[model samples]
Structures are given as structure tokens and as C-alpha cells.
Target: MASVTDLQYVALAVPDLAAEREFFGQTWGLTEVGEEDGMVYFAAEGMPHPYVIRLRRDDERKTDLVGFSAASREDVDALFEQVKAAGAKIIAEPGPVEGLAGDYGFRFFDPDGRAMEVVTGGAQRAHRTLGKGEAIPVGISHVVFHSPNHPALVEFYQRALGFRLSDWIGDFMGFLRCNSAHHRIAVLPGPPALNHIAFDVASVDELMRGLARMHESGIHLSWGPGRHTAGDNTFCYFITPNGNAVEYTSDLEHVDEATWVPTTYQPGPNTIDQWGTGRIITGNVPHAEMTPDKGLWQVPA
Candidate 1:
């Protein structure tokens, strides 16, 4: 079956581009790779996806794009056909991608109107294995979104992008996996907006060291520094300078595709945070105030 093999990048537009650039490049531990057409790109030290993040200046902070990767040009075309057949609004047909990534891809809006791209054959960068205690992201782990109609959106992802269900948090949150690191996308019921983007760190030690680094840098921790029951990942959440939520996570479970069964976990304090430290220490919960995304239904630049 044609499917997206992995998450490739997230493009964001922020009102304070300089602060966002500095925050992602310096504080968040991503390497600034290149800038083109007023957009800045950042790559993780441990991944060869060319770039993992793309940022640009805008009057309002909004998600610009979420990119995924396919194994080949054939898969890209196949996925494009599936997306079109599923009735998504197409932005561009499959073709050679513009700008630095350099690949064959297509663009479209998911059911909630967020822009997405699926590509293959991009330029790969030279990356190294990040050592323990490095306190930096290896690569993007997953992205969570808030959807007004969560079940239908989950179905859209499954039908259009060939994702499989991994688990659910009761009836409210759904985890979907493309290539078995448990989940690359999860959805919750709320307004149509992004909840957070997670980046994988080396280990629990790196997660803690990152907490200390964020504290010293004066960025407030939003929720976590604890473990989650679903993916069994340790998490620490923080808001970027432009109010975009991001997470540093470790120890995400990988599943065997041949024998995995999806579990619907009962939602509770301990289920969301197994360590019981998130609420006890930070006094913040996992839920956040969500409004419809400003960038929704708008064509990307």
C-alpha cells in the first residue's frame, strides 16, 4: 500500500520571526541550515531529512505546513491520488518541489484546512548520532492536533494517507501510526488547531537536561517532565516565543506491526502523566485553550 513513511518537517509563520529563529536555533537545539525566500530552515543534528523545521515572518503566528515523506516518487503519486480521491482540496499537483528541499511532491489541505505536503527524493543532510546527555532533538517524534470533529478527521487521515490506529485515550484522543514508532500523529476533540509538536531526545537524561536548559533560558514549562501511558514516552512541554507549543520527549514505544492491538485507555491524571509529576510540580494540565488556527484555509506562501 502507498503510505507516508515518516514525518519530514513543519513550517511555521510567526510574528516575531527573530525570536522564533533564535529560540529554535539556539534554545531548542536545532541547527540552522539555510534561509531562502525569507524563510529559515533548521535541521536536527541526528536526522538526514535536509530540514526538520521551516519558519517565516508573518503578522500572526500560524502553522504554515506539515510535511511528510514517501519512500519513492511512485508512492508520492499514489498518495496524491488517494488524497484527491478522499476529496481533500488540492493545492498543487505532484511535481518537482520548489526551494531547498528539492523533491517530487504535492500539496493539499487536510479536512481541517491545514496545509500538508508529501514528498520523496529530497536532499539528505549529513547527521551524527547524538550522544547521551546532549539535551537536543534527534528528530521530530509526532504532532498532535485539535479537531472539531475528531473521529472524522482521524478517518480522513486513515483513508487518505494510509495510517493505522495505534491507540486511543478513552474516546477523545486517537493515536495513528504510519511507520511504527507508535504514533506520528494524534488527534483530540477541540477547535481546529495544532496542540503541539514533539521532538525526540536521546534519553530521559537528555529530557531532564533540556528542562534545566529551558529553565536557565527563561522559557516557561507548560506541562510535563513526566511520562505518558500511551506511547510510554517521557515528556516536557514548553511554549515558544510566539505561543506555539512544543515538546521534548524520550522513550517513545515502537510497536511490531504484525501483532499490535489498539488499546483505548481510560483518561485520568495518571494515564496522561504516569509519573504524577506534571500536575504536582507545574500545576498545569495537558489541556490548553484552543481557538481555530489563523492560518487555516489560507494558501501557503
Candidate 2:
């Protein structure tokens, strides 16, 4: 199976370009790599990829598309053929994007109308390490999509793109990994939209520093600065200027694949907040009325 090498970049549409740009630049501290046409790209430290986040202005705020790098040119070709053979909604044939920096690829839509791209190359990194106390993310870690049918999306990812199952948060959610680091994409049972996009930081200290930047910008944490039992990563989530959820996370556990086992965790405090500091927000909770209050299930400090 020709699998994706890693997540490349995610393009999201925001209502206000200036506000979203400000939040990502000054608040998030991500380096402005470059701009093309009308979109701006934000570069992450330590990763050779050209950009991790792409922003476009639109009247409606929502996710635009998610890009994944294929293992090679041949892999791109193979996947393109497979997608076409399966009669998926083909946006473009496998080829080089005229103005884009990367290699040849194709674009398609998932069952829920989410745009997904698979390509071999577009841009290369300049090879730089993050400085001390820097809060800028290293790269995009993962994207969680809220789908109306979790089972169908999971099957599509596993059967169509070769994403391996990492774990499950009950029957309502599924985590799928392409090249380790727990999961690159997750699916949840709800309306189709971007749940949250997580970025990798250097350490817990750096994650806190990033949180501080958000605090300085008057953006409050919507969910956590606590650990999640599933990914085993410390997370802090906040609402973006366009109202989409974004997360700063560090220390995500990786799977060996050979020895890893997927388990279904019941919806509870341990599954939601392993360290017991985060509240159940509407971001990850579809039906809040059925969830217990934060006080009832919190682990004692």
C-alpha cells in the first residue's frame, strides 16, 4: 500500500484575513513563510516543509482543505489511480499544480465533502532548530474532523488511504495514523466540520509559553492545559478568530505498529481529561446534556 508520508499543510477559510493572520502570526508566533495569490502560509520551526498552515479569506469561516504528502511520486500515481477507480469525487487529475511549489498530485473529496490532497512534493524546509522559550509550533500534528458518520469515515480512511487504527474513544470517535505519532487524523460523530487542528510544540514548558501568548492576546483556553488519556499529549485549545478550534500540544505518544493495540475507551473523565484539569467543552462534546458536570468527574488533585 502506498501510504502518506506525513501531513503537509491545512488550508482554512476565515471571514477576516487580517484578524486570522494576526492571531496566527503575533498570537501563535508562527513565521510567515510567504504569500501566493491571496493566501498566506505559516511556517513551523524544525520542519523542512514550506508551510504548516494556509489561510484564505472568505465570507463563511470553515475548513478548506487538508494536504498530505505522499511517500513518493509513484505513491502519488498509485493513490490517484485507486481514488479514480473507486469513483471518488475527483477534483483534479494527478499532475503538478501549475503555481504550487510541490510535485505532482491529485485532489478529491471525502464522503463528507472534505477536501483532501495527496502529492509528492511542493516545498522543502531551510533546516533550522527552534530557539529556547520559543512558543511557535514545530509543525501541524493532526486534524480532527467532526463527521456525521464515524464508521463510514473510518472505513474510507482505512480502506481508501491506508490509515491504520490507533485507538478509539468509544464508538463515537476513531483515531487513525498514517506514519505514527499516534494519529494524524481523527473522526468524530457530529456535523461535518473542523473540530480542531493540533500543532506540535517542543515541550510542556513551550506549550505553556504558547498558552501565555494566547493569554496576552486575550484568547482564553476553551478546553485544556491538561493531558488526554487517548493521545497521551498535553493539550490547550482555544477558539480561532473565525470560531474554529485550534490546539497546542506536546509529548504525543507514538505507536510501534507491530506491538500496538487499539482499545475503546468509555466516555468519562479519564478518557477526556487524564490529568483532570480540562472541562467538557462543546468542541469535543456533541451532546453536552448527556455529559456529567466538570465537578462530578474531575480527578482529585
Candidate 3:
């Protein structure tokens, strides 16, 4: 099994580049770094390149999840083998992206057709003007994936990628970690577009301030300005310029290698929000009416 050394950046095929840049820039303070072939990349000053969002052209099929940046090239080699062994489909073989820096990796699809990958060392970190955690703290923290086969997939990450299970928000969400930074990725039970990508913040107050900015700018809040019992992180969701969800979060439970117990089980949403996650109906979300079940599972991953 290969270890999931670290979480690389995620690549989402966005429809609009200008909109995403304005959304991410205004909401999270991301700066537009570079562009190529109708695709634009935005970055947080803290995280490195290829982590940027890739805007797709009209004729291209939209890509859902493209995971990137593992801890080691060796781990990548090992997981590449594991992915093959599991009978998962492979698209691009592992290698270097000709035009990008440090993005030496490959592409494949998750069970649901999500374009996932393992990459590293592409594009140097330019650091965004805005990062997770301000006075409330800041920076992009982690991503969560939805899977129907939780245990089977958990083994994939645990055995092949070496993600230590941090805790379980519910039977649906499994918080996994690679580094001391609480969690890099979360495995959730299937069907929605990945739950959302969270960007770290300094405090709940900062989250509020950031939310205020979003509100004033007409960016409707998605989920909350509340706290979750799982990691003890304060969270709020906003629609980013990319149509991708970004969370402004703070105060997650800090753990050391010693006390960090990888556990699981479904927790009630009430426990998920102790500080009170404000009312969140599908209406607040952009495509809510279409996804009455909280998600549209059939979207090509």
C-alpha cells in the first residue's frame, strides 16, 4: 500500500474563468496566477501550483475531481500499482505535465467517473493575496469525497494512500489525515458533487467577517457559520466563482500522533453543529431545486 503522503491541489474543470477569479479573489483573496489554453489557475499564497482551478473550454467534458500531490514519488509509484490492482480505470499514465511545474503525476477515474490523480511538484507556490486563517485564520485546508462503498474505498486510501482515519462525522463522512494538519481529505458516502473544499481560517469571527464580505458582495451563504463537533472546526459555505464550494473554517481539534485515534460512526448533524450551524436548506445553494436530495448523484464525475 502506498502512503497518501500529502494532499496535492485539486483540479476542477470550471465553466467560467473570469467568474471564478473574481469569486475566489473577492471571497478568499486568491490571485489569478497564470493561464493556458482557455484555463485559468488561481492560488492561495500558502499552497503551490496546479492547485489552481482549471477552466475548461466549451467543447471539453467537465472534469469533477483531479487529486494531486502525494508526499513522495515512491508512494505515487506504489499507489499507481494499487489503483491498477483494484481495477480502477486509468486515463493518463503518471508523468510530468509538460507545461506545469512540480505537477509530475497521472490521471484516473474514481468509481463514479470522477477524474482523480496523484501529482506533485508542479507550479511553484506563488501564495495568494488571501489564504486560509486570518485573525480568524486562513488557507485552503482539505477536500471531502462522497463514496457509496465507504469501507472498500477507505481501504484504498488507507492501504494504498496511507490516510489515517481521523474520525467519523457520520457513517457518511470519514475524516482522514496525512499530516499533522488535522485532515487533508475526507471520504464521504456517495452522491453529491464532493461535499465541498474547505479553506482554513483564523477564527469564527474571521469566518463571520469573511461571510459579511460575501453577503455584501451578494454571494449567498451555502451551509453555515457554525461549528462541527467532529474536528471542532467552525464552518460556513459560500459559492466560489468557480461554482465549486469553499468553506471558511476555524478552530478544529488539534491532535498529536500519540492521541490521534482514527475512529468512525455516523454522528447526528446536531452534534455536527454545537455553536449552531445556521439554517441551511437546498434553496441557499445555487442548483438546489434540481438536486432535491441534497445532491445530483448522476452527474458525470
Candidate 4:
């Protein structure tokens, strides 16, 4: 069966669209690529597509939907069939997306009711390489979800989308990869909410500079500027104005499916942070405030 190759984007619903735009564009350094019907798109420098994060204005703040790019158009059709065969909720029938260049896909609700899209052939945006001090993400690296029914969600992704198991933090968290960058999606045992969204950066300097830039601009981190043992990626997480977690990360471990062996790691102090130094600040925004929604783009106008 044709499979998903990599994550394309994520849609989110926020109480304030302006705050989401300013936080992602000015503070996070992402470019505002386009907007329509109160929905805004943000993209990194040199991004091939129009946007990576789609935000919609709403009364409540929450995750909207996650988009994954299939290897080809054929793969998209195949996955749609698989999703239907698995008895999941189909939100949108397979078709082209408006304002997105030649894009054809469909939307569905995951086992936990989170919206997801399988798309191919979206419009490309104008490109520019990253320069000094700009912290715009190169691309969305991964998205983590607090899935209460861990076994069911894990099984759904693996069975329907052809996602492979990367690793597990015991039964508390499980990592699944569609591509090579460790895990593109993580399912954590909890209520239906967003854990965090990660972005790729050039180097350690870039990641630290992003942290510094956010600090100078009066944006502080919720947790991180540390390394995670699982993906082996360096991270710096901060709370967005809309009360959600966003991470700037680098050096994510890439796995070779043929030789890679999945491992189960028990929860420990150092399991989450290899550095074991950053304090865990669990609170309203990145913690309690981040719930799931049908991302701004997917919600009806």
C-alpha cells in the first residue's frame, strides 16, 4: 500500500487570530503567506508550500487538525480507502482543496476525534534561505497529542496510514513515524489535548538564538532548552499567545527501518529530558488550555 511520506502541516483554532498571527510571524519568525475567510497561514523561509500552520479564529483555543503528505496521489486514495475500511469517521470526501495548488485529499477524524488530512500536490510558496537571527521554522517536524485511548489510536495510525512504531516511553507515550525523523506523531496517555508542536531549525545555535530572541521579546519558555532521550533532539518549548505549546528543535534522530529495533523505556527523571535539568512547568496554557478541535482550516466557514 502507498504510505504517507512526511507531515505537511497542522491546523489550530484559537480565540484570537491576530495573536496567533503575531506570535507565529513576529515572535516565531514565520512568514504570513496567505489568509482567507479569517483563516491565516504561516510558513518558514524556503518552504515549498504556502503554509505549515493554519489558524482559525474561534471562541475556544484548541488543536484543529494535522495534515500528512502522502508519497503520491495514488497513496492518498489508498489511505482514504484504508481509513474507511477501519471504520473511522470521514469528515471530507477525497477531493481538491480550495486555494491550495492542485491539492487533492480528504479529512477524517482519528480514533480520538482529532481531525487529520491526507493530501498531495499543494501550491508552492516563494522561497528564501534562512539568514541571521531569524527564528522562523524550517518546517513542522512533529506534533504530539494527548490521546486517552493510546492502544486504539496507535493501532489506527499503524493499520490505516502505514505509520511505523519508533519507540515507546512505556505505556505512557508512544512514538510513531511516517518518515525518518524519529517520530512525526506522538501519542501520550492523557485527555484529548495537544502536547506540543515541534519545528525544525538549522543548528544548536539557531535553536538557542530562537530561545534568546523569544526571551528578548518577552516571550518565555514553558519548558526546555534541553534534549530529549527519545528522538535525541534538542528542544526549547514556549507557550504561544493562544495558550498552546510550540517547540524549536534540532538534531532529531532518523531511524532506518530495516535495522532499527523499537524499544520500550520506563518513565524516569531523565527519560523525558536527557539533560535532566529543565523544570517541568505544567500549567493552564500548554497543559490545561490545549484541547483538540477541527483546526481552523477544516471548520466550516
Index of the highest-TM-score prediction: 1
CA lDDT, every model vs. true structure = 0.92, 0.78, 0.63, 0.79
Q: Model 4 segments beyond 4 Å from truth?
A: 126-129, 132-134, 280-301
Candidate closest to the true structure, highest lDDT: 1
Q: How accurate is candidate 2 locally (lDDT)?
A: 0.78
Residues 17-36, model 2: lDDT tens digits: 99999888778877788888
Tell me the TM-score of each prediction against the true structure: 0.98, 0.90, 0.81, 0.91
Model 3 scores a C-alpha lDDT of 0.63
Model 4 per-residue lDDT tens digits across residues 203-234: 77889899898889888777777788888888
| Candidate 3 residue lDDT tens string, 1-301 | 5665555555555556556666765556655667776656666655655444444433322344456567666767777887777767787777765545365666676555566767766655655444333532235588776666766666666654567778876566677777777777776665434657777766677777878888888888887767777787888887765556667787777669788776664576567667554545544431221121222222322
Worst lDDT run of 10 residues, candidate 1, spans 281-290
Candidate 2 regions with alpha-carbon error over 4 angstroms: 85-87, 280-301
- The residue-by-residue lDDT of candidate 1 on 39-94, one tens digit each, is 99999999888898999999989999999999999999999999999999999999
Q: Which ranges in model 3 have alpha carbons more than 4 Å from their true place?
A: 57-62, 101-103, 126-137, 280-301
Please report, as a residue range, the 10-residue window in candidate 4 with the lowest summed lDDT: 283-292
Clashes of each: 0, 5, 37, 1
TM-score of 3: 0.81
Candidate 4 clash pair list: 64-295
